[model samples]
Target: MIDLSFPLREKVALVTGGGSGIGRATARMFAQRGAVVAVAGLDEAPLLQVAEEIVAAGGQALPIVMDVTSEDAIASGIACLADRFGKLDILHSNAAQTGEMQEDGLIAAMDADFWDRTFSINLRGSMLCAKHAIPLLLASGGGSIIFTGSGKGLAGDLDYPAYGTTKAALLGLSRYIATQYGKQGVRSNVVVVGLAMTEALDRNMPEAAQKLMTEHNLVDHLGRPEDIAEVVAFLASDQSRYITGAAIVADGGFTSHSAVYADMLRFAAMDTGAKA
Candidate 1:
């Protein structure tokens, strides 16, 4: 009996930063497919909303208010989930904050405090989540670990200092995890997302920035959170059993061209500034 559906019927998925953005999307998708879902985020309000939505539609989910940077919080939340669900089959390390999504900053110009906070949330946060979740995954006879990366990760775009660097490092982390744990039956991968119409994008980018994104992408339509969730679900499921150490770029031809023109446009802003 080969079932071709997105079969997550008995699996348990732990999604960090699941309150909103790609995290929220993944949580709902996992629930829909029958995973006993655990959503962790700094805020509980939206986490509750996601859980409630899943519950309303006849799915199981547990919402946990936790911090990605705090080891204790991560350990506690994961321990709790493992206790309730008996095992962890999927770990979605997707928690990060871009400090309101800053858009203009060269490396030397970036604040020291901002740099630390950025890596702490993006890189260290993922590691922290992975550290606690790995044992349970190994206990369940291996599973999948998915990290949310970005287009800026593959390039050095001075548009944002900390965000770009941390994201870039995440791929390295993902590769390491995949290599080290493959023999142990665990698989790791990354999703390098392009511009998506998520809450993060809405809060961080300006209208002009959004306009520029739409113009640059091959797909004129902005990607929705659901788009990313679908990919995550696929990776988490056994259907992708053979895929590992892959940085799946989900950008709609945005990075397909491979030139980060984000910096060149800075001169145009400077030119306008000079005229004034």
Candidate 2:
């Protein structure tokens, strides 16, 4: 019988952007679930810290300094993973150009260089990583490739046009990979994420803004990094073996409801108060 427990025993996994937030959480979870994780990111400090933390927790981890925007860097990172682990069974391409929301604003005001940079890191980086990792994945007899996408990709937004556009493009890239490599045992899928309470968001978002976002969410609380990590772990494991070329939304119902849902709730509350 197939193992339904979603265990990733002895699997070798790589998580880009594994220094913090969802990537860090997923790397930890993957370790806990029996996978040897290689945490790759641009910064060496956090990567080392995350890897140390995993080691402290009785899991094996390798911290790699990688700049996804550079093909040479990505190729070197993958080579390091292969050198250390011998084979790769799961790859979570979670790195992206972020933290410049204001600069990535409306297309009309978008900086040409900024837009190019966003695509270079967010879209092109993922492609390059896949191109280098596919041979190893196939060597390991097929594996999963999970892309970290965003809800903005599926909906029009007032800002962050470049970010949204790259995320939207990820959906197509994932589908293409899934189609091209499915017969060869590779699976590629996207996880469309919503706002989560990460360090950056918690530090930047105001209380009122958080409250407003919560009101729009169907869930009682905003998402946490661990929440998204769980979804990614599922996709990384064999439990989701039959799933590929699809986008799994883990947005806490942010994209599930109608655009007017939040407003409708407020109007209903007012009507009820008036009747009372």
> Pick by TM-score: which candidate is best?
2
Total clashes for model 2: 0
- Per-residue lDDT for 119-232 in model 2, tens only? 999999999999998999999999999999999899898988899999999999999999999999999999999997998889989999999889889998999999999999
List where candidate 2 sits over 4 angstroms from the true fold.
1-6
lDDT of 1: 0.87
Q: Quick one: best lDDT, which candidate? A: 2
- Candidate 2 residue pairs in clash (backbone atoms < 3 Å): none
lDDT of 1 by residue, 1-276 (tens): 325564888899999889888999999999888889999999889999999999999999999888888889888998899788899999999998745556337766767887888888999999988888888889889999999999988877758767888999999999999999999989999999987798767886799988888766777677888999999999999889999999999988788873655445566789899999
lDDT of each: 0.87, 0.93
Error of 2 at 212 (Å): 0.9
